[model samples]
Target chain A: MSAPHSATSANGVPTLDVARLREDFPILGQQINGRPLVYLDNAATSQKPVAVIDAIARYYREDNSNVHRGVHALSERATAAYEAARETVRGFLNAASSKEIIFTRGTTEAINLVAQAWGRSTLQPGDEVLITHMEHHSNIVPWQMVCEQTGATLRVAPINERGEVIMDEFERLLGERTKLVAVGHVSNALGTINPVARMIELAHAHEALALVDGAQATPHMVVDVQALGADFYALSGHKMFGPTGIGVLYGREALLDAMPPWQGGGDMIKAVSFEGTLYSDLPYKFEAGTPHIAGGVGLGAAVDYLAGVGREAIAAYEAELLAYTEARLQEVDGLRLIGTAENKAAVASFVLEGVHAHDLGTIVDHHGVAIRAGHHCAMPVMEFFGVAATSRASLAFYNTREEIDALVTALQDAQRIFG
Target chain B: MDLRDLYQDIIVDHNRSPRNFRRIDNATRMAQGYNPLCGDKLVIYITLKDGAISDVSFQGEGCAISTASASLMTEVLKGKTEAEAEALFDNMHRLLTEDAHGVDVDELGKLAALEGVRAYPTRVKCATLCWHTLQAALEEVDEPVTTE
Candidate 1:
């Protein structure tokens, strides 16, 4: 799997050997609809590498046992592996300690935990929880639920036509009454890379904490919670080339200590009695009952695989791939590209002149070009764009330029059929 | 399995120039249908008089299959009694969902264009969205119908 590091692009950046990278993802080798699969739906959920898949299988085959309580050798090994995975996650996010990392089912559960545990305890009536217009349903619904329960207001910061958050509006929304600002590090629908570090600074200036939804960002770029000054960061393991049913919530140690546990069960209890029960410390306090032990181990292996490939190289390579895709898509007559933010990831949402997105998606799938076609779970953004739905082609590092060409060809075929 | 089968010439023609693609001003009953998955939405309007559908129309945005289905449905349902329209709805649903060989194509007329939807399982909802809305309007169901 060794590629020449000396094969640098003109700008001194190392180019990703995509062919070599694609070999790592076993699913990419298969066919769809009698043709080679051209998967461009990474923003929804990424394809996992063999390393993560093998790690999960290995855990189940060799050391399938309960963690923390049992004295058996298998239990000890499982416990060590699970806790070691936590440490890997801590390092992946560049968090200060593993105690701040709590495992949840995925990004949705992580955000809900904060909304219920922290928002319920801290937010007051007439207070505002700020979020952007382009937030996914996962980010918006949790805050809405929390606000409903606590009588707190949910304020939305406006985004410009390019799908980038308006700094002035965000600043205006951040005032003394704002208790928390929850925003996505990347817009899953538009591929807009938000300026979350600056947003966090603005939130802090107003005495409000910031939570970054890094579900879309973790797969494409480097995310350091400390560097971004994020009070809390949420990400899904499945979206980041790991297994489903596992995710990490990175909170500041002080905040984790102050917040009450969202769920209560065996693992979260330090000492239990009929009259009185004491909760465990940070991390475990939030992670109650049996955890997704194999998922955590798979996520750790995913982290190791990503590090081995190098995040910087992936980012750079994806930038070129995105530029190429956008250019090729522009050649298609009557194809309108959505979300042309100056700063973007490799996701492209578009609509053809006369064809409905669903129709286009169906036709494209026939050609084995798998793209997401719908509101992409960001209905508010769809409303802003004045489109009911858009066909999206989101790229990962493993995608080749040839696959993008195949997508373009499929779209052309769709146009002919609809024409 | 062919794209031509799914996007039949009749379906494309109807989609391009949908019949009765307008809201009824004196509509006695109207119901909205939405497919949240694809973001397709439509409203079915009907004027019932003497137990017969005196006037019928629809206004919405959806895929070609949906638009054409609604257009053809409006054309077929103009003089139909409430019970006749219900029977036709059941027939169309069966045509799209069940085996194509089992369907009586002679009864469907222009609606047979949508028979190709039987081959594409995911699109069965798109072709049936309008029929469902039509049923809701006839039944006077207050809640919006959704093809989940």
Candidate 2:
């Protein structure tokens, strides 16, 4: 196959017009603290476009009905809309079938599903579950729960100072006793894009299953589940410009077919008697009750919006923005940039001497530059860096170089004030 | 009314050159407090003589508010009796959470500078981390308490 073109359009036109994209997201146009909003918190949650919001609004206005079992016309329409969302997500991830995709609350719930269902069933008392040091709390906590419940052991693969996963150490950690390998496709705190394909192959070599936390990666990069050889993949829709409360978990059909249902309530049952109940098959088996219908539809709309802009184009544009942001931030005095990985998304985690991150964030916000402060939910990463917290500015494709300049200027002001 | 007022000249001075910022050679009571959320680790050592705070000191690594709070706390509590220190600490806690419509701070002493922190909801933990640590030390509580 020819090298995949990274430009916006098939005809080489820009996929997302920076100005037009800004218009699509109404939140981007608002003013915060008397300054125009410069949103650099995309790693937390990208701003939703009018298309996604309207899609959700239209769902509740017109097609508001319970799905799966309803025989009425509204129910049929709602069911089709919901199932169509599954197909959209399946296509988005390039999964083999829609049955392979299960919708959960978010990446956290999806990971818990795999850990409780597959992990609890497969992992023995002495088996080891390996994860990297840079994993989010969601990925780490569920595996820890599995380990605690099953008498299994948890092993951590270390990362270098640059926040890149040490592949050699990860390979060394994988042994015959390793039953599962859970790793993130990208580090949320550091923005390091991990070599997950290699990590998955290593897990396979040890006869273990690999679950990729794509919460941070799916929005920034093109993800093909088959190409990555990921046995299981979990992603939050909100991170990918979709609505919150809707996420996707893609499991290989055979693997999902073999595992037991994670939760039991309304919809995940085929037959129920006082004696015993037979579970429903595949995706439906995992979805326990009334799903987030409008959220799912909004997620489908998000996929549609992104597909219109094109994934490769977004990736290239974000790469340029990341480079621009790094160069601009490098000019700030007494500023130390964290997570200097060779391969990373558009996240800049930094600390300024004599200025607390909370103070820095507040001062920056006075200029309407929104960045994240605190542990960024990766306390281990903060502890490794020996700082309480660093102010993080994460970008999306919709972000522009002008916004990065705004952030730099804001940081300069913060330094002057806090110094 | 900018929150920057919270990081006042006094707070900055205290943060830059904290009072009693050292390990006590001999301590009557010592307790370590850690804000795992922000990674602010503090070890507070107190020298008490007959229900009076004879000498108090602390050493830790954290943000400006936390370090400055530690310094001010040590400075004010060092020469006071246990009852006086407890009352003052309680007043400081009230200054943080209680509605600041109009509260007199003639009794708060130097802690009045931290009044600006009440405006920003997120930094309350930073201001109170050291105070809570001191409370834990005085009460002889061993369990690590996270202020966040």
Pairing residues by index, what is the TM-score of model 1? 0.98
What are the TM-scores, per candidate, against the unseen true structure?
0.98, 0.95
Candidate 1, residues A91-126, lDDT tens digits: the string is 999999999999999999999999999999989999
lDDT score, candidate 2, position A49: 87
List, residue by residue over A1-419, the lDDT tens digit for candidate 2.
02222345686745556776677788898998788999999999999988899999999999999999789999999999999999999999999999999999999999999999999998889999999988899989999999999999999999898888888899999999999999999888999999999999999999999999999998998999999999999999999899999999999999999999999988999999999999998789999999999999999999988887778888888888899898988899888999999999978999988788877787888889999988888877887887778999999988998899999999888766666
Query: Residue by residue across B2-79, what tens digits does model 2's lDDT show?
Result: 646866888878877888999998988788888876677898999999899999999988877888988998988977
Model 1 lDDT per residue over B16-109, tens place:
8999999899999999999988888999999999999999999999999889999999999988999889888888888998876766788778
Q: Pick the candidate with the highest DockQ.
A: 1
Global lDDT of each model? Answer: 0.93, 0.88
Q: What TM-score does prediction 2 earn? A: 0.95
Provide the lDDT at A57 for model 1: 96
Task: Give candidate 1 misplaced runs (Cα > 4 Å).
Answer: A1-11
Instruction: Report chain B TM per candidate.
Output: 0.96, 0.93
